[model samples]
Target: MSKDFYSILGVEKTASDDEIKKAYRKLAHKHHPDKEGGDEAKFKEINGAYQTLSDKQKRQQYDQFGQTFEGANAGGAGGFNFDFGQSNAGGSGSGFEDLFSDLFSQTGFGGSASSQEKVGSDVAVDVEITFEEMALGTEKKVELYKRVLCDKCEGTGAKDKNTKTCETCGGAGKVHKTMRSMFGAIQQVVPCEKCHGKGQIPKEKCSKCGGDGVVRDYQKVNIKIPAGIEDGQTIRATGHGEIPIGGGHAGNLFITIHIKPDQNFKRSGDDIVSKVKISFSQAALGDKIDVGTIEGVIKMKIVAGTQSGDIFKIRNKGINREDRFGRGSHLVEIQVRTPENLSRDQKRLVKKLQEAGL
Candidate 1:
């Protein structure tokens, strides 16, 4: 049975060029073989559908013919001569260097043609740190399992040093196939599954990497955390991820920070809030009291006749700004405690004073 390209990509037949590309990218990322629970067959199917719909002429042909386009290839193999290098190889001054230069510029690969190579998959790890560490930076060493290129095969996945041209695609790395449609014929070129688009086959397979060119091993990485980092923040380390198949590039490592709460102090934006209890006499008569702050214990003065529930601000006693902009003020909420019981002598003295009205 023929597959519906539009339905495969979850898009309409009349979708715009940008819309089609966007849908293809989304599906490709979701169904990529590197991802967990990914289906290789579904990924290839979406790739094939996108390969046809992304081109202007092919899409027009498919719109008119439906599924018969598979028969359009000259040899009925359902392939097309796309000449992906045509744009660069054309003109009198163009050459392989120019072709590679253009490709590298678009793909962010540096001078090396191998820079176009894909990197390995990325891995994510969650870490918990104390609030003090979040306030002040900290370092962590984490152990992770990741794929690394096989040293024996040098990432070629071959035990023997020799390599031969692929027999399936004749070193072209692609197979030509034609599809017959009611409207006409559509030709397509697909990557050879046996050679995996490499257009070459190794003489022997590497036992260490199982012909996959990657081995799973434990790796230790050190992460330096900056001060004032917030909870749930993520930090990325480039090239510290899983190695790609056949030794392309390495993926990134993402570390999510989880900050633990402090028991004594509460954070409010950039400031720190805390409470202090004082005796009723202390509230009535001015006195110096020691309070805990981020820096340390600081002495704060209580004004005479201070009421309960009154707040006192200590300058630069709060949490430091993450950006080092300045320190915040610490607010201390005062609570007054009254005497639960009074002695008989104290009561008698209070009664005598009341009677004298002195």
Candidate 2:
């Protein structure tokens, strides 16, 4: 049957192979007979189009020869069919059933892999940063001892960089197993344990990776700490984790930041809170004095009649706002110092004032 594969999938002719595959996956999921209001005929048509358009040579032939060309190419794939919903339930459908089975096993929706390549394990480490470091963005390098791609063999897992097809599963890299489950005897296509899902085998294995394509080694990873990052927040470093055995993607590195508390200053949101001690004379007479802050020391006015424990604000003296929308002020709580012992002259002056009041 002739079909406008692009129109059926609703993609432009200029779309890339990825776009075509993505469109096919979307339509296939929508029309799958298992879901409510599913349509079998429409599902078949979509699947048929994808089957022909996904392959490079076949796609090229179809694009040049017209829609009818797909039928000839899809002869094998079309002959094989299993009910999408029921193939797993209890049916022993043959041919394309196993193909569909493996396709569904991919991650997410359209995670295409010739042989299900596994993702590596993630690495996590806690890093401590000073309070000042939090205010200012900084970068840190962490020491890690973990699996990495083999430099000697370039992760080919072959000693001589050559391999023959695994004897167990041939070049298919999968073994069909008959197992008993709730449904009954279901034929399952699993990765060949011997070849580890690589269709071909290297003639010689790389000694460093032991044919697994990775080795446990030391690495120094550099991570960036953005300004205003809160304590105990984790930063994810992509592809910094362990190496996959079959030459796939590396996992991620998670960095948990711990901010060390500063005794002289406390952070309240974006604002810096602190306390300052002023002499009784300074507080009473309203003198200007230097107050220590994150932005060095700045002169602050001690207002006249400033009482103990009174809070004063110094504008733009706190942590700089991350958004660059001005800055937070330093909230300084004032503490007035009182002398415990008075000198004879001080006592006489105090007595004269008391007597005058009396």
Candidate 3:
């Protein structure tokens, strides 16, 4: 229902085509329904807005009419159109597919379509790593229990496969489906159930996988977690997920990383921060102490008359850069701990010093 295409794409009305394209690409990637925490509703809205604004003629008409006309002035063969319950069963019906085709092409998103086979659905998993492990890239093996293509059948779903064009969808991999609505029957293009969007079916079903072309199995996939990867970021492992329902490019496995917090160190940019406590005597008179760094424990000096909240830097003692060419400095903050309980003799000595103004 949002009429402002510019506001939907987060751009000014006078924004250029490249600016609009940049905004659209960024927003589409962030809000893509395939990503975690993606919003499908918002994705649809942005798609509609971008579709209108991306066209020069449509953009001009939309600007003049302010979406109230919805470009009804241009009812030409090439202009965008939306009509329900009017499409015949034999002729082509349009709705979701038309919009998705245009948006997917513009956004450069693959795996949405198929030629001879269908791509599989993506799989997502969560992984946890220690701070050290995150700092240094590591490899891990993950065991996944999901549908895999039948090895015996070679994903053709038949011992000796012979393909026949699907009569139901007429080899289109999609069919016009009509559903009743309050206004009337709404028709939309949906994947054909019989052929499963492959546009063809095997002559005979495989005994092991039956006609599905996939079986429930366990697969071990080794993932190379790179250094400097942020938490909540997803890593896509190509062809490491479930096999396509019919057969095409295998789906990607998306791994979301969670980093465990370290007790002694905290991350700040590329630097590591840690706090150390020193006695009042060490702060006032200065002392040498062993401080822990990412490399190891090193002796550090506490300057004389150092006050609380003093910071000391250890060069190149923090996390390594992604390229491992250099490292960030470790910052150590000092806290002075005063004596909580004093003996009678100690109190008397302190009182004498106070009286002498020492």
Clashes of each: 23, 12, 0
Specify the highest-TM-score model's number.
2
How do the candidates rank by lDDT, highest first? 2, 3, 1
lDDT by residue for model 2 (7-66), tens? 889888777877876787678778876668877678777766766666566678888987
lDDT of each: 0.70, 0.73, 0.72
**Quick one: how many clashes does candidate 3 have?**
0
Candidate 1: misplaced stretches above 4 Å?
1-116, 151-154, 160-202, 314-318, 321-324, 339-358
Q: For model 1, what is the C-alpha lDDT against the true structure?
A: 0.70
| RMSD per model, one decimal | 10.4, 8.7, 11.1
Off by over 4 Å in 2: 1-115, 172-192, 321-324, 347-358
Candidate 3 — which pairs collide? none
Error of 1 at 285 (Å): 2.6
